[model samples]
Target: MPQQYGTGMSHTYSTTSSSQPPMGTGTGKKHDGYPTYRPIGTGGTVGTIPNSMTESSKPVYKPTVTYAQTSRATVEPKSSSSPGQMYSKTRSGPSSKPTHTGDCKTPGGLPGLSKTQQILLSDTRADAINNVLTKNEHFKFSFGNKRTGGPGKGGEVVPANRKTFPALTGTGLGMAVVFLGPCGFNTPHVHPRAAELGIVTEGTIVSSMIPENGVNVHNADGTAPREILNTLHQYDATIFFQGAVHSQFNPGCGNATFVAALSAEDFGTGQVAQELFGARNNAAVADVFGDAIDGADVDKLRGAISNNVALGVEQCLKRCNINKRK
Candidate 1:
């Protein structure tokens, strides 16, 4: 891959040449286009994925239509397909108003919009854009600040998705800057609506994925656990297929940062263990264990699951000297 796509790589890859090339070789980025089913390593860099499609190129998300102001706005019946069509068909064409085009194209903010598009955008979208320009807010339904390494615990995730950044409504793209503290774990979760391409920018991350079970001829029983994807370091990239339960953990004693780009505007997350145990169904939880668990111990499990970020390999936490926050 380095030889084919990355002449700038420190040690260029080759069939005849060694994986480590001569020391004086030209150096820059890695473009290791790896496979998904095995090591799950991409060894990627900028311009890596070829001809990637934008949001508009994807299946347009058609949300359930429920309008409190349907009649008030003369909206088309509750059967409108796309959210864009729902909002746009009711309005006229583009406004003559000047918009925010690359710093107004002049001084005094003269030609720029005081706000986002008036005619083309709904009020909901305008407010979302304004907040993004002016404030530091959170993505939708962050796990009460605890799951992200807790308050002042150093890990953080800044996400830009449909609910958080409305400007990307039809863009078919969402991303997050994931910062993980020592032994910090981004829990096993599924993005139901989108596939994610993630690149670790700092530190080492141990990533794993449990694919949806089916008839795998090699491992037909499905009792065995899926293998760890890889221990990815700087510039290493990986892909999490849609609806695959995957996780990234900081294995070192310091910190790690990664960028995850999803091919959806509203890529929903379902944290597996937390969602399963945090629900209000204790009897069902025990039934999964064939009622082997005592009712009292079930409560304890729920309490522990409540602190999502506190969950990680015990050995890793001990090695990192990271104390679990409450």
Candidate 2:
């Protein structure tokens, strides 16, 4: 009969009778007169066998195993549908150019302007030109039909003030056309609000300005700041920095004419001598001029300054024995 040895009935083997020797006993004996079975090449039975054995028993067998050499490769999980892909963060070339923020459409490539500011600027510019045009005929008559008037005709100024000129309101700019008489002057004064720029159209003039500090100090070479002397002639131009004492004189025997412009619409003038000497009382005046200038002399000087007449002209005429020419 055949007998079971392990948990599964999948495999079976036959041995000898119950009185015969067990499997792997190796006693060189047969069991129940049956031949003993041993594993090939090992010279031994795999396990002990039951005494009751039969010719139907069968032995379990194992399959041979083999190993082959292979190379290892790393792989990353796929972020997209495609697998084993690669990427880089490095740039291919230099950085791009910077962007411009200024308003290129505006004149002078100026910065961005508010809508109100742009509208006001356009309106004022047209208005300023129109105002001059409206007064063109009147000025033409005053100028004797010439672009520039001649001497003996004297000079007149047309000022653009916010109160008098509606075009100047909120414009932040003002202008004046001046025609000076022979030996005339604009006087020593300062603009309270803005600097002044003037261009001479005809004749010659001596432009003088003492800084507000009143120091006529000079360089080691005797040259002063800006220049030692500011003398302008026809087609010449000059700028008087803000708040500095300045004046223009018609040094030529003929009349002089110039065009002047200010940055502010409401630019006002304060004559230096009148503002200092004439506006203050006697004691305050004495403190500034010192006791050397008599109180009576101070009063006389104040009156002279208020009058704005050029000094030393009469003396020059008398010394030169030449008759005065108006």
Candidate 3:
């Protein structure tokens, strides 16, 4: 006899005497030595094994497993008064936000974390929204020093990353704080990876940009084929797309400051004015700009721009009709 275990029931097969002889034998005599087998039920029965197969050649019956049984094998057994009784099982999952249940670990479940990692791992949507009052990176890290090259130019940048401002972890963003003294300028520069959105917090500035598409492809007047220029004042905002050559100048007598947010954490800079005009010698500068610009003009421009003082402030002030200090 053999037994088979199915999803919800069991099946059995056994040898029994047959009144009729085997299929080819015409003699209608009972055969009990090698008995034939039949399923007990007409409906809802497992398929019978073929009679042609020898008893030794047939595959053995095996039990079919149910979902509940499979689940129980791996899961910890629940204790109860009766062994047959089961309690509902549950498993803990990763947190919806960064959280530590008194134990420091990343969302990735690694331990032995740094203070910066710990803070970042505890961030949540609710906590991030309240950053203006708590752990505000700009106010805490950048606002106080107020370093400047001169009256017209200096900028403090918060390159928010896991290392710099851990609270911004998982958020791909950063900021630049530009402060211009009356008649100060932030020289022509490009953020290779970031597009910038800036708001003027005080005074006025002339914002200018030559798009990357127009860098080598320029008009005959030595300007980019396409350019953007705007006069921004207190509370005025502007956007400079990624990889564009741009500059800002304070045209007002009063000091100016603007806060800019960048699209990426590591926004790199290339200052075009310094690289092109502030070279140590004339030959390098002329080679950089090519034969289109005269060698004499390159030297002349280099002398004018090499100073720590910003070059465009006086011209900006004059055009805006703001006085340039004598």
Candidate 4:
């Protein structure tokens, strides 16, 4: 039998076992059926284990982890569209002319009315001239064969010529005359209802408006019969009130013309100065002149009609309702 340790066998045995060594022993090992105990040495089993672990100790290499190099691009934003460029493209080129619409028609590339309408409008003037010629043929003349006769030839009255201008038939609004004569005198007179405006067209003219009585003032005491207002060579104009006795005399040697526009239709055609102031009605003359006039002076003044001084006073007084005697 092989040496049995615990069982009975034929071998020499010690009383102490290596497997069950004492507590303070240095090292131990297993032999046949027994453990041998020994002191630890420099070349023992603990130092020799490095040689057995040689397979895991060799250098192990791992491929380094790397990312490929990449580039990022920077982008810019765009600007907004302009209004001017947008309008020009829509409205203003040779290819983009505005189309005429509605009632207006376009002809020959021009706007507004056509040529035929223009010709019809021009023919209207000729029609107006023909109408005036037809009306002139119907007028009849009564004072035939003679030129100037009627009331104008005799000094008693001056008849208006109808051929030059028609007689005023409407309101009492009078006629006007633009006198182009040389510098001279105009006879003194009164228009019953008409006011007169005398504008000096040429040389200087002296004009005066005097009241009924010869003296503008009655006496130094200031109780005057009437007032006299006169003006000389006034470049502008002079106005004579209705029923005011007035006269105009050109004082310059050069030719003078005046435009006299009156308010009455007939310039006192029926009112005669001779009939109103004759001596046969001396009482009427005295009523206007008071004690200032004698009967002989009235006759002398009336006889001086040739000198255009039949009415002695240069101007006439403006009519008024106020009685100065009161």
Candidate 5:
């Protein structure tokens, strides 16, 4: 920052170098074409920098920027398991935080994984999380410090959640990639914690979203579900709001792929069809159809909920010359 000369109470005058002379005359002498300063206050200092002073001459200024200062006490992980792995924690996570194992990995707060698979998920997630932190080398592969989802049947979904990559926690961003085979479909689902910005990276697919109406869509309120649809070709993009019911279907014969950047690290995915049919109360679930199907046949439909990546559009399947799978 440029040095300041003012000390007392005075009008805050900017040290603006002007081509014109000061409003009043200046006490300092003008050398070359440099503007001069005049004493016109009692609170702040007033000084003029010469337009022609060399770095070694009259005034000197140093950089006054302080970067990346936070109020959190940073704690480093020192363990025999994950040596040299480091993380900066703000300690702002939920008060019921899980025990921090070695390698900067935690076992709680992962929306989906923590529910039923806690015992099974802890070790698997720890390994994956550690690999991301330790194997991310500086160049032999970082050739640049910068180098570089979920899907259905022929489709694949890779969700980059906190469990798989603990670095993503509290980052306000997450990712999931989906691949769809010819006539493949990504079933209707809602991400309770995240809004998604999706980009089509390959082939073509139809997408849709239905957000809650007005203040919020509630099951108790019997809010009607309204869906809006759009088609995305290669390189096209679209967005889905949090809690919106969304779906994607590949219309072309070739494989389709899309990447979704979500707004929350633990964004949870609930496939609508699976959740609706997954209820143990068969009568209650079957009641949703209300006479649409015979009661005797309802039992057969119990486990028939289509997979997230199931076949879509038999016409498209025929056009693509892909055999239907049972």
Candidate 6:
């Protein structure tokens, strides 16, 4: 006999029958000594394993950590000590008076004077010197004094008769004065580094200065030179600029005097005048003659004046339309 279980059915057989030959050979059997089979669509029954038999029976989750926001504190720098404290520490101590020494620490120190004494001494010395020089007549004469007058028309010049100072000696800076005698005329001349200041002392006089070219009066054919340009004239109380080629003639019939103050002690003729005149003459003669002046003609009339003088005079006279005098 065999027992069978399936779908709420149970059977027990005690004897074998021919119709069911053997259990293994039975047909249309639902169970074969194992669990019964059920298709998913049939909905007869469903089965599953217990929770204890599966590996994921209990789940695990790890804990996470979060950080809090924070800010860093700022630091301040230390302060320095006060100026008074620093100075006192460096100097060692505080004293009311400064130490004094008989000899001054600076170069050229007041040899015999303290600070106050030195000031007093210097003032006294200056005052004494000024008094002595101002009171002395000789000192007054040595230096120049001022004068006044009026300027004349047509470039008339007044002469100034000044006492001649001692000629400058040695090579250093030198100063001198010249007095133009009444109705005295100072010939045209140039000075180097000596600016002249003229002061009128008496009657009205006319002063005239001519450019080097302005004096050209000769022609290429050996005629007398004529005035090439207008003259520069100044009246009394007027100062003339120096360093230019110029001449002054006293037109006053009466005695007239003026004082001329010059930069240099000695008055010397300058080369600019000589060159300007020489060049002017040469150029004028050459242009008219169609060639350079020969030595014979140059010596006979032109004299030994520089070539520059000839050129300058020629140019000036030609431009001014001045005719050569016979």
Candidate lDDT scores, in order, read: 0.50, 0.48, 0.51, 0.36, 0.53, 0.35
Best by lDDT: 5
- Deviation (Å) of 322 in candidate 1: 3.0
lDDT of 4 by residue, 107-200 (tens): 2224354333322233353432332223553233222223232221101112222222232222345444323122234434567767877777
Candidate 3 lDDT by residue in tens digits, 77-112: 333333223222232345456454432324345567
Q: What local lDDT does model 5 show for residue 146?
A: 21
Q: For candidate 2, give the lDDT of residue 250.
A: 60
**lDDT tens per residue, model 1, 1-326:** 11111221121212111122222223332223432111111222222223464644422222222222122323223322222332222223455564554443222233443322321243454454454334444333342342444322435566777655645566688887677776655655789999999999899887777677761334665455454367799999998889987777777777788889999978887767646675435655433221121111223333323223223345566676655432
Taking all chains together, each candidate's TM-score versus the true structure is 0.45, 0.40, 0.45, 0.33, 0.45, 0.27
After the best TM-score superposition of candidate 6, give how far the Cα of residue 118 lies from its true spot, in angstroms. 27
Looking at model 2, report the run of 10 residues with the lowest lDDT sum: 65-74
> Which ranges in model 5 have alpha carbons more than 4 Å from their true place?
1-152, 213-225, 279-312, 323-326
Q: Rate residue 163 of model 3 by lDDT.
A: 53
Q: How close is candidate 6 to the true structure, as a TM-score?
A: 0.27
The residue pairs found clashing in candidate 1 are 8-28, 55-172
The model with the greater lDDT, 2 or 5, is 5
What value does the lDDT take at residue 216 in candidate 6?
A: 51
* TM-score (C-alpha) between model 5 and the true structure: 0.45
How many clashing pairs does model 2 include?
A: 7
Q: Over the stretch 34-138, how does candidate 5's per-residue lDDT look in tens digits?
A: 455432222223567655886556432111211222344333322222322222233344555566654343344344443224434545645544533444431
Q: What are the clashing pairs of model 2?
A: 12-58, 13-57, 13-58, 14-57, 17-51, 18-51, 155-179
How many backbone overlaps does candidate 3 show?
2
